[model samples]
Target: MLNAIDAIRIFSGDFQETKTFFVEAVGFEIGFEDEGVCVFDLAGTKLILEEVDLSEPEAAGMVGRFTGVSFATDDIKSTYKELSAKGVHFEGKPETEEWGGAMAHFKDPAGNVFTLVQYPPQN
Candidate 1:
């Protein structure tokens, strides 16, 4: 049986920029970068970004895709503030989420949506 998701891939038009956004803005650790690919490690999973050339005539007329990645945090507000001070622009301020957590959502340079969440404190 599968124990967990080990990696998730995200397509990117500019892999380096997307890597930087995930590493610096989203606070992920870049584990590898080679050729046209980049990878970052979340707590227990890996986020992989692969480059795709869309400007080529053969690649034209194709829709660009973005991935949504969610992250967990212990303090959403503090994480949001730290990232904001480091020049990360959030989609909105952290709010009480429907899943019983505080959440802050934002997008990367490659248009990938990501969320940072803080679970409600245990009783």
Candidate 2:
């Protein structure tokens, strides 16, 4: 049987900088952290940041890639402003989609892309 996603792991070249971005800029509370890994509680799911050696083949090509992690917000405009003020830079202003929702894009210190989505309310 299938269940919810347990965790999403992100590889980082600079652990401290990347970790600071998620914890301080993104406002994610640290669930646990060690020498090379930091775990954050994203709502209920876990967001794991692992320090990786870019010189290694397995991790060399994975840094600075799209993470495919989208965070949901009730108010896109407010959320955008809040995060921007916290030193988070967005691609641009939020845009409305054909599905009647709003979305904004941003990248972390490691250049991994993430998104903020605001879905339309049910009638």
Candidate 3:
């Protein structure tokens, strides 16, 4: 069985801008970088941004796609405020979800969506 996700690949039309956004705005440390790819350490998992040709059939549909990368935080509200202050634009304030957790959405420079979530405390 698969134990864990080794990395997540996100496609971007503007590689430099997307890489900069993740490093500066999102506070992810750079793990590796090259001509068309940049890797970031996302708490342990690797977040890989790859440059792609949007005109190509296979990659055309992936541009601006929602990544579904959720980052868990102990305090959603404070995390939202801190990220917003760093020039990160969020969809809105954190809201309660049907799963009883608080979550907020945001996008990277290339419009790849991600979320910040805080689960309810277990008794």
Top TM-score model: 2
C-alpha RMSD between model 1 and the true structure: 2.7
Model 2, stretches more than 4 Å misplaced? none
Residues 7-59 of candidate 2: C-alpha lDDT, one tens digit per residue? 99988999999999988898989999999999998777999999999889989
Instruction: Give lDDT for model 1.
Output: 0.76
lDDT for every model?
0.76, 0.92, 0.89
Which regions of candidate 3 fall more than 4 Å away from where they truly are?
none
The TM-score values for the models, in the order shown, are 0.83, 0.95, 0.92
Q: What's the CA RMSD for each of the models?
A: 2.7, 1.0, 1.3
- Model 3 C-alpha RMSD to native: 1.3
| Candidate 2 C-alpha RMSD relative to the actual structure | 1.0
